[model samples]
Target: MQLKKLILLVTVLAGSYTLMAQTDKNSIDDKQNESQKKIKKSKTQLKDAEANFLLNYYEQDGDHSPVTGGRGTEKLENVAPTFVVHIPLDTVSNLDLNFGIDFYTSASTNNIDYFEGRKTGASGKDVRSHINAAYSRDLRNSGNAYSLMAGFSAEFDVTSFNFGGSYTINSKDKNRSLSLDALYMNDSWKLLYPYERRSDGTNWLKDDKRTTMKFGLSYSQVINKRLQALFSAEVVSQTGLLSTPFHRVFFDDVNGIPYDNLRSFSHVEMLDDNRLKIPVSMRLNYYLNDFMRLRTFYRFYTDSWGITAHTASIELPIQITPSLIASPFFRYHTQTSADYFYEFGQVSKAMVDAKETQFYTSDYDLSDLSSTKIGLGLQYSPLLGVGRFKSPFVKNKQVQFKSIGLRTAFYDRSDGLNAWLVSLDFAFTF
Candidate 1:
């Protein structure tokens, strides 16, 4: 009896010790997991509020001004300034604000009073202003995110309002992502007709409002450690006043022609009331070395107006130093003419009067053309930023001058149009 009791006691003690050991192991594992999660959260949280300022100067010159019936100078200059800000609402949410203004002068628009031989004044210059706001949030630990946006823009001739939303899903490993977005825009025009055609006492347009809808889907993937790619597709639909009220179209027939010293016959541009467009694009990036990267892009576009376009571009970004980068890029684009697009004096007035066609336009933008753009961009950003200053709005805080960027480009079109653009950008963190 004594031997049996001793054996039972030993067995019970061993079993109890084993159970205690397992419980301690589980507790340690739970604490370790909780600590790791905290570390990750801390690393992912936003640390500062960011802001950017941008300034741009653009100028263009070309022939074939639609305002002058596609046979005059098309010279324009513009200065634009934009500001952007991003604020962290929480660990997983952010708010973004963007505002911009554009000041422009156009010789083509000045021609509105050319027929009357009046001096171009306010008709040649205009200002446009725009503002946009967005809010975005991420679903914690779910790899899902969403954003909502609203914007408005106004100018002397038109006002536009837009609203949009986007949803994104990322893979658990963060190597792949898919995004979907949709937007709607409404534009209202003042119907500013040309100087010579204003008193014709005719209702030239059916509606002064235009509506546009866009939907897009994009997918990005990390093919390998050295390569990444993105594919995107979009569908766009537009309705209402699709033609410019002030653009003039000339015809070949008698009523559209001229006698000795007579002015060429012209009418307002016309187009379909509704249109549809589809575009697909792809971007590929390859890490060539520690100091250089290659980025390539291609796009195919088609529309219901009998137009098709293709675009291809390549860029090489070189790391000049730890804090500096330089990128040189080239782009080429080609497009077929729209079905209703006619050059200067290509369409006959009698054919239109006889109802041979329902739509016609002399706008060079709708004509078959090819274009090339080449540019270089430089950026400089230091490890701790270029400098720091005390925050004006927040006490006991500092703002850092994060980076500066400069970009310049030259663009040329197959049809006698050429343009130059230069822009500067500055970034700050508070």
Candidate 2:
């Protein structure tokens, strides 16, 4: 069924693109004439609109599974496909649309029914779909622009609605800029608990809503012809139902009560419902001669739950040929654990008895950890098209192949988890 759904989705997207291409071909002449008239009235001319498509695949395997009290299978796989379209409404206004879907399966999520006495547990696959639309307008040629966006996401057990806006101001020479953005989201979830813990199967969650608000500010400056820098800061706050209901927590001292079909006694995970997060980051890029460039990034993050993290990364892009580029990158990150975090089957009776420390979790993701990732990528883009062929259905309309890219990466964590990923991207233009 999932494969069928994926195939149907791809077919619909392809059909839509074909229809759009035909429509654009039919209206090209009218649009060109209209654009010429607008250009004659204004000094600045509009550029051609563009559309892009991207597809990604990822898989991972690890031994720690939070659903099994942080020590079981943590295998997962995911595939995502996305499409973006940008249209110029006028010389100073534009509209953008993005649509995406993700299909994922997790062995850890399947452990929610581990006690059901099944060899592999129940199905843990789900599909998520989302769309975003935005409109941006230049207030004036003097370097002021504003944009507004709305987005929605839906999955089997969760739905989210988001709204956001951004304002940007650029210096006269366009070498310096500042941007401010604000966003709000409302997420609703159908809380599903572990099979053995659901008392009345129907009475899963009393409150299943989460609300988040975020604000961001950024500044970019061009220091010289070859160097540029950007700094950004963000504040995020979330409230209500922040913990996963299905994740289990085991105590060191068992109370002689045995869980059904399981060797260890476990309870549903619990934690505080409110959290606040702040992150600040900076990026620097340098162009060296005509064949090489360097990019560096650093970030510091902290949260009210007593977690602190640091991240740093660097990438170097080298031009192998006029039409080919190679980039290699590495990143490192480390974080302090949340105050209420405990290992699998390691929670003490004293901590459980104390009301203040009752808000605890055995989720490894909230524990102290260090991680590293390294990757390489190659891109091929020709300066001039090899050739262009007219569309069979639209007279005088031609399309050209643009570029291709391939990337692979390896990720390792201090907590005995590792993963590898590879991806390919292709682009075309009309």
lDDT of 2 at 179: 90
Candidate 2, which segments miss by more than 4 Å at Cα?
1-44, 119-123, 201-206, 254-264, 386-395
lDDT of all predictions: 0.73, 0.69
Best by TM-score: 1
TM-score of each model, in listed order: 0.88, 0.85
lDDT score, candidate 1, position 6 = 15
lDDT of model 2 at position 329: 83
Q: Rate residue 350 of model 2 by lDDT.
A: 74
Candidate 1: misplaced stretches above 4 Å?
1-41, 119-123, 254-264
